[model samples]
Target: MPRERELILGGQRSGKSRRAEQRAADWLALDPAHRAVLIATATAHDEEMRERIARHRADRAQRVPGLVTVEEAVRLGPALARHSEPGTLVLIDCLTLWLTNLLMPAESGSASPALAETAHAGLLHALHGARGPVLLVSNEIGLGVIPMGREARAFVDALGRLNQAVAGACDRVTLMAAGLPLRLKEPG
Candidate 1:
């Protein structure tokens, strides 16, 4: 399947995306023919998010000049499958937002429960079957206080399960905090 798969877990502003970008840049630097593509899962619903995405776009462009990007929110499995090439590195900016989209869709009744389950399975299958390298970024939000709302609690639990499954599928797993990485798992 994948040449290498890495899962980067962290909180907000914890440098997970930066590390993924750096990995992409390094991969591109290794060979002239090497390529990198970032699949962004975020949808800018508000002005603040729009600015944040724009800032990330500009910063990533400056940091990794040879990198390309593709925006995919729900259909990430097919997108990943399309981008996974032997000479390329595919990076998924964040899985948290993707989960949110599938679970609590912004468009009310757009995403059904069965659809979310199918999409989640598809994503894991794609990761396992990738031909090139894959870098996944996800938030670690279960460490904080318990949320009062049932929906909030369900989201946290779902994310935890999703993270666990992704981590198990990955070749390496790292926890990021204060821009530092603590390696959790690595292939021997």
Candidate 2:
């Protein structure tokens, strides 16, 4: 059977991550040996972020006890390749943060376009050929008003493109609003 690939998109606090976790749990429940892995991309660069990460960990432990976590802030393609296997489910907590990490300026104060492109290509390739169920979560930033800053605008554009590419690769695509999921794409 072909693997299931899903993309969950939503605004902040719209329950995208929660939805992904629920789907992962459901997939894991199908078989005793089915394993769930969360590929977390968020970094604890601030106290608030650290707290948020901690809360997520606690929630996952309580809500999805069997799910394991893998922290991959940049090299998501390699991580996915290593974890995605038959009878395993991988949930990428987010793609927006991962894009941000790729776009961040180096000490020279310039973003490397080649590096970002390569990483993006690698991730898409991995997702397209994954051997197990994969759930990817990403913020829907295109609905908002235009940003004034150039960097912010670039980030938004990159995220929009990334989401579109992932959605194309996914067998299912869902938009979350008010904790409700509206299916955009259904598996054939």
Candidate 3:
């Protein structure tokens, strides 16, 4: 794989995470010395979510046995910095979940707006300074009608802005629909 930063955006079940995993798997297949690390940003807040995470883990392991997994719900900047290396591919499985962990914490009084901003900035900086290739997966939830609740609206807006920022930072951006990828930005 080329040394580039790529972002994948899609709706739920639109195959964003699957595309990122495929890229990581392809990168790992290139050489024995190559390494791939998946930064999982999902946090289990309920039983169903916990089970979903477990299922994803099992599926990913079967798909990419060589890809190492690192569970990091918050502090993604630090996680990316620590794992990014010259011969390594760093894949973030989803950015919206990371944003949720920031803006809408399951436990109240854990994160503030300023904290979220700082984390967001830190992630951008880490991306700019990464020594290896990176693939980021994120949701594109703004394609439908506006949300009803205030919190839902806020989350939607936040994710939209976050996606724009990451897309600008990446060398390539792709939108997935029905398991097919449409290239939005090509690396120059």
Best by TM-score: 3
Alpha-carbon shift of residue 62 in model 2 (angstroms): 0.4
Error of 3 at 3 (Å): 2.5
lDDT (10s digit) by residue, model 2, range 1-188: 23899999999999999899998888878889899999999888779999999998998999999999999988999999999999999999899888877888433467776788899999999998899989999999999899999988988888899999999999999999999999999989
Candidate structures ordered by TM-score, highest first: 3, 1, 2
lDDT of 2: 0.90
Worst 10 residues of 1 by lDDT: 108-117
Angstrom error of the Cα, residue 178, model 3: value is 0.2
Model 1: per-residue lDDT, tens digit, 1-188?
23899999999999898899999999999999999999999998889999999999999999999999999989999999999989999999899999998988887855466777798899999999999999999999999999999888988988899999999999899999999999999986
User: CA lDDT, every prediction?
Assistant: 0.92, 0.90, 0.93
Q: Residue-pair clashes per candidate, as listed? A: 0, 0, 0
Q: lDDT value for candidate 3?
A: 0.93
Alpha-carbon RMSD, each predicted model: 1.5, 1.5, 1.1
| 2 or 3, greater by TM-score | 3
* Per-model TM-score versus the true fold: 0.96, 0.96, 0.97
In angstroms, the error of model 2 at 158 is 0.5
